[model samples]
Target: MDRWVCRREKRRLAIDQENHLGYRRFYNVMWYCFRQRGSILSISNSSGAKSEQRKGKGSDRVVAVLERMGAERIYGVPGEEILDIMESLRKSKKIKFVPTRTEWGAALMAATEGRLTGRPGVSLATCGPGALNFPNGAEYAHLGGFPLVMIAGQKPINSSLHGHFQVSPLVSVMEGLTKYAVQIGSVQMIRPVFSEAFRIAQEEKQGPVSVVIPEDIAAEECEEDEL
Candidate 1:
């Protein structure tokens, strides 16, 4: 009987020890996960602070508005007229820039994205021929009621750097292909204009909207309040 009791005690002690060890291991794993999560949150906070400290430019504000509007991707062919926008896109973490071989491809991709996602898909292009490439895709989106936003670059409007070279009546052309089309003539108009465009693009009978931004305006510094 004593031997039996002794064996039972030994088994109980072993089980207890095993349970304790398992609990300790569980606690350790939980602590490790907590530490890892803390580190990741701190890194994100630091990066957010850095972005806040960075100077706000027109293109940066434009990209910011796009992020706020929930645009996840921008399809385009980069050009000299949109260098500032390209730089801003490169710095953005929320919205990815997709480079295409041609403006037509970019517009088609954006239209497809809009059709699939049920949100306004964004496309970018330079003035003149690049801007003109959007018509076919824009019309397709407009007719199909797929929400789309088309952004096109232009030479400096405030200066004569390009001297009317490669200029086209882009807004007028796009007006027929999209639900709404306008040119952003001032830095202050970026936020409201983009907001309205996004809103309109998603409204009833959803269709394409077009915006034209000049190179100089995109490169200009934006006021803090504007951001």
Candidate 2:
């Protein structure tokens, strides 16, 4: 019995050490990305070259609306469905995209930022599996009363063809977990839907919200006023 007890204690100590190391690594990464630069968000853009200056487009409006709502950074892992949105973020000076290794980590980081800053922290993910990874952290944000906004890119809404491989009812899946959840059907809905989501996330008893923007909707053309 004494030997068994000693072994258990040793195991516990090993687990604690592992956790401490993980936390120390995360903190070091955060220091390099934000604190050392005096910016809440990292200034680095994924594309090595500067993004061309753009006045107005569907994607541009999405970025503009997010900036106007006072979002400084968004965390995400980039994927094809979300490429246009990432491009918009890259072009915008007002908001920075903080890339992460996984969707779950992005969601957790955003939630932590939201909790600390008293604003809705934004997380982005691609459709299907990419978005499926978010619920773990998203549910935590909801239960903890963190103001988090989960923005997911969806498969093209226009396709009626077979093999809508990555397509799933994301809005339906997220509805139960988030205070506000919706799928964007057009460029016109982008601004109002996200604006309402921001309001809901920041209101009393704050929690998480989910917005699913379809690929075609993001690719669609738009005048600035439409958003």
Instruction: Write down the lDDT of every candidate, Cα atoms only.
Output: 0.92, 0.88
Candidate 1 global TM-score:
0.75
Q: lDDT tens digits, residues 1-227, model 2?
A: 99999999999999999999999999999878777665423445422223323225677788889999999999999998989999989888999899999999999999999999999999999999999888887898999999999999998878872588877788888888989999998888988998999999998899999999888888888754554
RMSD of each: 11.8, 24.4
Off by over 4 Å in 2: 1-55
Where does candidate 2 have its weakest 10-residue lDDT segment?
46-55
Clashing pairs in 1: none
lDDT of 1 by residue, 82-168 (tens): 999999999989999999988888888998899999999999999889999999889888889999999999988897655688998
Q: TM-score of each candidate?
A: 0.75, 0.74
Best model number under TM-score: 1
Candidate 1: RMSD over Cα atoms? 11.8
